[model samples]
Target: MALIEIERVCRLFEDPKRGKPVIALDNVNVRVERNEFLCLLGPSGCGKSTLLNMIAGFDHPSSGTVKVGGHVVSEPGADRGVVFQQANLMPWLPVWENVAFHLKMTGAPKAERRERAQKFIDMVGLRGFENHYPSELSGGMNQRVGIARALLMNPEVILMDEPFGALDEQTKMDMHAELVRIWRESQSTIVFVTHSIEEALALGTHVAVMSARPGRIRELLPIDLDRPRDTTSAQFNDYKRHILHLLRPESEHRLEQAA
Candidate 1:
């Protein structure tokens, strides 16, 4: 059975001025296997983030459903952890406290929370900075804190919505490697949203290409490239070309017409 399943999910926004609802996702369907790294890639304004939000239970679909671990998701829970485009950390708290914020919410002991946070802090390469505040960190370092925070939850799936979008290219690449290593070591399923094709190709075991507004899934491509993927390899380029073609306007028009 799939670890996460999005079945014919659709999200619509009602605009009173337009006298009609705006469709965000149109009959989107996807199944994610356990331990799989799935990337949702598309143009800006596409429903990729919307879909991720639905899976995270931060939002609901207008039609259909999202199921994880054979349970229908109705609200946000510990089973799913989310990392947003911005690293939304508490400015007043130190790194370890921020990482263990969830545990703190449930009234975990101070020393226990600190110990749990340290494990993930080290996992994300943020060991020595546990006592530092968010303001004391760089963008990349803050993002690492965000990642460690999510890992500390030990959720079944980690949903990342452009978590690395704000970083420098070099820093983003470094984070991608760190993320893959973490994913492997933690054995957690992940659903990532991104606009960068290279980022998707570099990190995903499977890439789901999504359409523009009134968003719908266009294609689901599997990446069989070896680990520590060679981005410059011919096979990688071939897959990139395939993905580029799927994201092209003409391809979208064809799919819309077919629908």
Candidate 2:
């Protein structure tokens, strides 16, 4: 079975000011297989984050179902981990402590927490900075800490919503490489939401291209390129062009389709 299944999901929000129910997602269907890095790619307000949130069980669909491991998702569970755009680390705690905070909440012994947190901290390349506070690290490093925290949970799936969006270009690129390595080592499924075409191309095994608000999956494209992708290559650019074409205004896209 697919590790994650989103079947004909729809989400509607009551827009009090507009006096209407706004459709955020309409009959969205997507499935993520085990260990696949799937990027939800589209413009802002495309319901990418909404989809991720549903998978994480932070929100529920207005209709249809979201299932993980063949069980319906109802509320937040430890089986799924989440890393948000912001690290959201506790400012006062050191890195290791922050990464192991979940364990701490469960009354785990400190030594056990330290050992488990160290494994993931090292996995994320933050071994030497375990004692540093969030304030002491760069934006990218803090994000690594957040990733490590999620990894420490040893969840089957990790949900990320534009975790690298705030980083500088160089830092984001570095994190992308690190994340790919971590994903391979951990063998965890990931569903990432991002607006950047290049970022989706760089990280995803498959890219789910979404339409504008009242979002729907336009296409799910397998990224058959080799790892450490060459962004300038013709094939890579071809994929980018196709995604851009899919993302064009609906009228323009239909015109091309009819041509």
Candidate 2 local distance difference test against the native: 0.95
Give the TM-scores of the predictions, in the order they appear. Answer: 0.96, 0.98
Best by TM-score: 2
Number of clashing residue pairs in every model?
0, 0
Candidate 1 per-residue lDDT over residues 131-151, each given as its tens digit: 999999999999999988998
RMSD to the hidden true structure, all candidates: 2.2, 0.8
Model 2, residue 180: what's the lDDT? 97
Query: Alpha-carbon error at 237 in model 2, in Å?
Result: 0.4
Task: Score each candidate by Cα lDDT.
Answer: 0.93, 0.95
Q: Show pairs that collide, candidate 1.
A: none
Query: For candidate 2, what is the TM-score?
Result: 0.98
